[model samples]
Target: QVTLLQTVVGAHDLFDVTVQLQPGGGIFQTFVRGSGDDFSVVVPDVTRVNKYGRSADCTSNNEIRPLCYCKSNLMPTSSPSSASKSTK
Candidate 1:
């Protein structure tokens, strides 16, 4: 099974996210900003990486190069209070 091993948040105002995959060897990274929307990344044979807004999905792939699926929802501003609540 694939798992999210590590993640790093960016310093800039822009949302920069990086995720490390486990069980195999794959890395997924992305940046998000502006209106709320979804974005997808298709690697097409290695593995599928799904990124939602500032969140990232990194998973290992058994195949040579699988398709990556990334979805994101951008917002005008990020609310720290709301984020904290979700963590709990």
Candidate 2:
């Protein structure tokens, strides 16, 4: 199963987020920088790594590159007073 690992308020309206897939799963290191509704996602491997987003790899007889990234739309949601978000 995939789980959210960390969330830290950063400077310049940026937030650091980390997600880990359990039991030998892919680890996603993502960054979200924004406030309120709209946010930007920063996936460093978005270019090189194929996660079925931005770039993709489908299995076939001619070419077979397994998907190495996990897709789970998880975000932090709670009062700032509590540590609802888990951290690494």
lDDT of 1 by residue, 1-88 (tens): 3234232255333444445554233465555433347533322223246422223234344242333332322224659998899899
Instruction: Itemize residue pairs with steric clashes in candidate 2.
Output: none
Local distance difference test scores for all models: 0.41, 0.44
Q: Please write out the lDDT profile of model 2 over residues 8-72, one tens digit for every residue.
A: 64466665555554422444556676778988875544221214332222233323223332222
| Cα displacement (Å) at residue 53, model 2 | 21
